[model samples]
Target chain A: MGPDSSQDAQTISQVGEFGLINRVTSGRAQSPGTLLGPGDDAAVLAAPDGRVVATTDVLVEQVHFRFDWSTPHQVGRKAVAVNLSDIAAMGAVPTGLLVGLGCSPDLPTTVVDELAAGMWEEAQRVGISVVGGDMVSATSLTISVTALGDLQGREPVTRSGARPGDVVAVAGRLGWSAAGLAVLGRGFRSPVAVVGAHRVPEPPYEAGPQAAVAGATSMVDTSDGLLADLGHIAAASGVAVDVRTELVEVPQRLTEVASALGADARHWVLTGGEDQALVATFPQGRPLPEGWRPIGAVVEGEGVTVDGDAYAGPSGWEHWR
Target chain B: MGPDSSQDAQTISQVGEFGLINRVTSGRAQSPGTLLGPGDDAAVLAAPDGRVVATTDVLVEQVHFRFDWSTPHQVGRKAVAVNLSDIAAMGAVPTGLLVGLGCSPDLPTTVVDELAAGMWEEAQRVGISVVGGDMVSATSLTISVTALGDLQGREPVTRSGARPGDVVAVAGRLGWSAAGLAVLGRGFRSPVAVVGAHRVPEPPYEAGPQAAVAGATSMVDTSDGLLADLGHIAAASGVAVDVRTELVEVPQRLTEVASALGADARHWVLTGGEDQALVATFPQGRPLPEGWRPIGAVVEGEGVTVDGDAYAGPSGWEHWR
Candidate 1:
């Protein structure tokens, strides 16, 4: 059987802890750099370039995702996606993952199996594997994923290197996830694409290392909305970023959905989070890399502005808020 | 101010998520392998030997730690300690950690700060840093820790490498945590040391690499009971392990506490877990390393036998059961 065929209807407690783990991990393929996989004291991954990029993210039920809105598979995929976005932001090639899952013991074992299946499916897309993990019983469902990546001996594209007069660009779509969230909230049957985006964001993973190769000075993943995340870059680089919203291309689907919901599509495009689009700053005359399109420019100042004006709407999603 | 002075009385929502993260991470020192610390999308670490060892563990309130029983500081320390023990079991030198915390929004923000302080304090003991993390709101308090380690060019001593003629030995205390658990269960105010073990286990960190240097054939940490964890080794190695109970020197303190609680000290020594002592198999003629004492030997068969008989007591902690 191919990877991810271990589907069982048994409850976690019925299968027992070890038995459930074995069922979830059965028939998985180990990717390159994973010298050792799960079932060991710890897994080993090769870091040939002598450095590894590491990041972690947590997703909580009701807080991050609701079972009614998304399947367990989608939740699992989203968990890996968010963590992978952080690794991508570092301009690194994703290598491996360690997943920590906390769930109610009474939950059907098939839920965990599906979660593991989705995780493996996503990791496989990036040519990586879930090398190690831990599982525990908890009152609420929670997923914690830590992603490891390799830089291949190149300098990491950090947020602090943006220079005045640099071109600010983006890869992939923005506002999709936020739009998806709205669609779900209003109980509207959004377009399949929009609903899927809300369930599992599609990050521009390859754009990160590609930007680094094309001499991008700074880079970040738009996790907490385009404006808010760019504000981070502007703050760190001691420069101002101006995004000409007109220059940002938004799909017709978003505008259509916004009109139907009596919301401004621009609001989602500017303030939406979890789209995971890669944003970078490059020297003004440098050739933009493939998959990247200029959205605005870096200027001499502080904070982020759209059309040279400070954004007045809600900035982004804050966990406490 | 020192590295861990972020204590405050404000609630998490009052401090705000980012503000609390800044407060908790303030003044911490970067360990040797840390190339980049927090505040970025991710962190970078040096893996000098071209490989990195990784492990993760999750601790949930009520399931793993009760607020009435463990101080938040102890809970935080225990989270890191358990993850570290896995790295140690792989005979690797820990270099960094990525922590994920989920807690009720109503929690006093100082609790998170104290938890972070405790994590930093424990990580400092082994000269590592909390490189990155994610925080979110949940119904229950949860801590997920992923530890990264360097093997330092030595072959990892996996549980499957033991031979029939190899000697079985361990470093660090056994049964103390189990005995301590009984004391706590009885509602008896035990000695500070005993109570401390149950709250925050002290693993013999140095002995992991020491065993590797001494050519340990197989290794594991006794996170599960001695028989259960060693059963893992036995099953993996396709050999039987024979433990001589007489050779196991249980401290008189454990016996005294066990009697006071109307429990069998030997039962705790044989079936209790979470002590995190390093157990390994070495060549029969090889001398036991300092801090390690021989307690058993690998025999020709599968499964573990205590004094040539199967253990009948509870095996160990099972997440489901």
Candidate 2:
């Protein structure tokens, strides 16, 4: 059943803002790092390294996701996952989250309950909690999540540190979400693997700090596709990246799905976004970290290329373009 | 002129997401505590006190403010001010901010420029910066601001620490925003004082730490009116608060405005909200902090009272009510 089909469901307006807040925050277990949780003007968190990594991502219904395509719980998980991935890309471990939710007053409180439950589930995976947040009435459903993390005394892995003769490696799935999106777009849900991947990404959260320990020169999450995000590193570091298709593995599952859809799996692997895979450049002589596979090389130039040739078509997604 | 009346103004879609992001972020100065700024996967801020205070607030167009009554610049300032006030209420000084903006594609880029300028102006006022943010397309203008702060080694003064013998005091203006809102609702904009107060609040940022230093036992910001916020302290601290009308000062300027509009100035002072004022409970013997004035007392009871009596009207604003 759809979220709004229940005629007797309690609307958020009926419960009121304070009531909803209490329902979402009450009786929740917080992590050790959460010094002070919800029910206050602000939340206090332990920053053991004396530094904090913070990032925010906003997801609007229809613009970023669809209620018809994904459940409120899945949407909630995706929202928190995307922001936490940004924190992970910084080579930090997440400490807490603050949510800013805007939804129509007619929205069912059950939707909010499921959404908060999904957020808490994702946060618990990283040993954190939704420490604080704000809720307000709006015309549409908008979720803004801010994920905070601790650096653990390591220097931040920014996009500007890549150098020549560095090997580019990636940890986590690539193009799987795009494959899932394609299946869903074709009105098919049987391939739940790709659809689930598209619904909630499994970002390589620990690989960020692991890469930092492995002396990664630069690191970024493939939220905007591999080549496009690599373009950021190239532009910031004044270097060129060339992805070798032979070294870049296009998973057999994606290939089969692409064959059925009459699409290019290679293109999906190189340009699909939202998978939240961690891509980093490291010195050429050392072994890549476990779970990381070599995919490309950094050269003393600019822009990204596949097999040293520019790939045709749009590189990645950009809003309002 | 209205924001959309400019025929030649470029729309946000024309600039595209990256172009707009670069336009808003380029050449912005960051605070000394910002270890890493925008143009990254995440921002790294120096949390020198080994702990961080975090809060999030969401403001939607029309729901929170109207362009017909206030400029986007004013809206931006109000958004940042409200969040920073939460940090201050925790007895922490703000270090940085992250913004999540969702606007329609047809929105004028000029509006974004002005909004960002106003946000920077307010951030600069507190010696901080907008370190990172996300921008996306939505049907309405939604702004979510996440503020991070440093406690400077002092314990956070939560709302649950008030005692029976505690004195209740306040710093900064009260009922001014509600007065302004009333004036605007009546279509009379001549009194710039109250109108501007409604447009932007002047939260006493330093007064929070000052109250902590002055031995404040419990504290809260008056975002939901003086009496209503005192009710929060009362409920959380398991104590009752009585506001002595004889001791509370209703400013003369508000009186003049109230008289002109045939309204009660004292009532506005008691129940109006959005002043961003700091309210706290302190021990009975010590002198109050500078800029703080005694207004009430906490005792062994429940709920809040106005001059030892129940208030006759609504205490404060609530969303979806």
lDDT of 2 by residue, B256-309 (tens): 999999998998899999999999999999899899999999999999998889
Q: Candidate 1 residues B210-294, lDDT tens each?
A: 9999999999999998888999999999999999998988889988988877888888888889898889999999987799999
Error of 1 at A279 (Å): 0.8
Categorize the docking of model 1.
high
Candidate 2 clashes: the total is 0
Write the residue-wise lDDT of candidate 1 on A119-229 in tens digits: 998999899999989889998999999999999989988989999999999998898988899999999756778889989999999999999999999999998999999
User: What is the Cα-based TM-score of model 2?
Assistant: 0.98
| Fnat of model 1, as a fraction | 0.87
Interface RMSD for candidate number 2? Answer: 0.5
For each candidate, the alpha-carbon lDDT, in order, equals 0.90, 0.93
Top-lDDT candidate index: 2
Model 2 CA lDDT for position B253: 94
